[model samples]
Target: MAKTQLNVRVDEDTARAARERALERGMSVNRYIEELVRQDTGEAGHTFVEAAADFMKQYESVFAEEFGAAHEGRGEGSREHRNEGRR
Candidate 1:
């Protein structure tokens, strides 16, 4: 499925906590945050990942059409070309 990027800002303390908790779970910060969001919005026996896959399967072409060909055939999310925001 095509993947996109999301960036968020938080205070240092919040960032530290996310780092520590992600470390405790032995997962990348990205996957850890994904798990947290999954738990928050998920129903028992159904995961956010499953729902996401289903949605993507159903609407991926629509997204590619709406967003443009640049959004097509994308793999994992990338930050390689991002412009840094001002502090």
Candidate 2:
């Protein structure tokens, strides 16, 4: 991949924070910012649908336990009697 230099300006406090975060992550400030952008943009590779599916799968048992019975019985009782023989 081709890399380009990007000049950016940040307030002194922001710059200090970024430097500290970069050190904590064992990355250069530029790399830390790049990773952040990549993750935010989903260029880190997982698509939105894939991410959502994974999240749902992780908590699927919780949802099923909570609503499975309610959903299962949702349409069992008819609201009104229908005219079965006449159109």
Candidate 3:
């Protein structure tokens, strides 16, 4: 893949922090920024729907458990009783 240069301006403190973080991570500042952008843009490149689906799949069990707990003991037909021919 071809790489392009991007010049951005930041406050002195932010630049210093970025440099320190990059050094701590053993990456050049450019690579650090690239990684930040990659994460912000999402891995596997820009497919938000795929990412959302993966997120849902990952948390589906948790969601189901919470939902079941919330609805537990409501009894069957509780919802229908509430509606009661209101259509």
Candidate-wise lDDT, in order: 0.77, 0.84, 0.87
The digit string of per-residue lDDT tens for model 3 on 1-87 reads: 899988999999999999999999999999999889888878635666788889989999999898877777576657966787687
Instruction: List candidate 3 stretches off by more than 4 Å.
Output: 44-87
Residue-wise C-alpha lDDT for candidate 2, range 1-87, written one tens digit per residue: 999999899999999999999999999999999998889898877766788899999999999988887666656352322333334
Instruction: Tell me the lDDT of candidate 2.
Output: 0.84
What does candidate 1 score on TM? 0.49
State the lDDT of candidate 1 residue by residue for 1-87, as single tens digits: 576799999899999999999999999888888778867776423865678889999999898788766654343443432333322
For each candidate in turn, give its C-alpha RMSD to the true structure in angstroms: 19.3, 6.9, 5.6
Q: Which candidate number would show the highest TM-score if scored against the true structure?
A: 2
Best candidate, lDDT-wise? 3
Each candidate structure's count of clashing pairs: 0, 0, 0
Model 1: lDDT of residue 86: 23
Q: Find the 10 residues in a row with the least total lDDT in model 3.
A: 40-49
Better of 1 and 2 by TM-score: 2
